[model samples]
Target: METLKGKTAVVTGSSRSIGRGIAERLAARGALVAVHYATNATAAQDVVEAIGKAGGRAFAFGTELGHEGDAERFWAEFDVQRRAFSDDGDTGVDILVNNAAVALRDHFQDATVADFDRMVAVNIRAPFFIVQHALDRLRDGGRVINISSAVTRLGLPEVIAYGATKGALDSFSRILAKELGSRGITVNVVAPGYVDTDSNADWLRHDKDAWEETAAKSVFGRVGEPEDIGDAVAFLASDAGRWITGQHIDASGGTRM
Candidate 1:
């Protein structure tokens, strides 16, 4: 019923995969969505086109995160695009989804300093500064949804650094909720287990034995789809989730349950 009829949303790393799912769902719910991409303009444009084809509105923006001035550059492009698209040239946004991240699969001893630093830069540092810089542009009663991982809860040793970064994001969401509560802004985390994305296509979709083993992790006895997490994010971004904040929702299809 177009709950977000006039709202504007920014979803980072939405060129493809789970982030694209969230952006598409938000657009379908009648929000003006800005689909942010790092290096894949074509993929981002494809997502925007797909949303448009679905009778939704979306635009693409490019900004490489995890670098110096990354947040500033992203906002600069975002402001320009938003103003161009807004009917009254308003630049304020109602939803900010931090879904951009890097996954490095390495054990504690095998992980290099460069790998750790890069993960920290993309996963932890970027979101922190993005929120800090976006506060002014984010209106009262806005939603801040951070995409996290089930690895944080499962303590998977392969992606120790990756899990730690998401753990930090969850903590950040809790504290940020309190800080922004007075402004009526809600902050929360949506943690997903192994979803069948291209990133995991090799193991989860291609290899039959690997797929079966992976699916067994969830009590549902199946792999979680991108839409599963996307729908959850959509609910949290909607007004129906007004009373929900400072929380972590496991959109993992009962993984490890």
Candidate 2:
């Protein structure tokens, strides 16, 4: 339907998995997508090729988050690349999806200080500053969707620290929504549960018992897919979601319900 025709979107950590799904969906809706990756130039380019083959426009950008000046550098790179695809001089972003994060599977007792710091830096600090740095480039009516985890609401012993970071992101979104309301910008969070992505493939693909256990968390008796979460994000980025902001929309397929 081209609901997002003539829009520009940036999806972080979009080289693979859930981020890739979101990037593709936004492109399919007619938005020119900037797929951000921390490393792995090959993988990022693969995503761009896939999108192009599917009749979508996209470009890949590599920037390591969780470091000083990274966010500013990211925008600079985006601005240069965006001009290549844009005929008009408009380099502002219409949608910003902060989907990059670091997940440390360390329990409260097992978590190391280093692990916690890395997670906090990547998951919380990066997104926080990413948004702050993007304020000037974000269109007045832009959409900000920060990907969170269902673990924030549910009890996940393995990723307790990781979940906390997402909780913080949710809080940030809520306040930012109110703060940006006057500008007509919408900020929201999308939390996913037990998604079957490459990050989980090592455990899920090898062990049938473990896979079943994870899938059973959802009332639908199945694990969530990248597209499932992507669909939710697409809705939030659409004009239909204009009335909604400062909300946490669960894309977990009724997990633990």
lDDT of each: 0.92, 0.91
Tens-digit lDDT track of model 2 for 122-190: 898988888998888889988999999999999889899998889999999999999889999999999
lDDT score, candidate 1, position 45: 93
Q: Per-prediction TM-score, please?
A: 0.98, 0.97
What are the C-alpha RMSDs, in order, of all predicted structures?
Answer: 1.0, 1.1
**Best model per lDDT:** 1
For residue 155, model 2's alpha carbon misses the true position, in angstroms, by 1.6
Model 1 per-residue lDDT tens digits across residues 23-122: 9899989998999999999999999999999999998889999999999999999888777766577878899999999998999989998998899999
lDDT of residue 25 for candidate 2: 96
lDDT of 1: 0.92
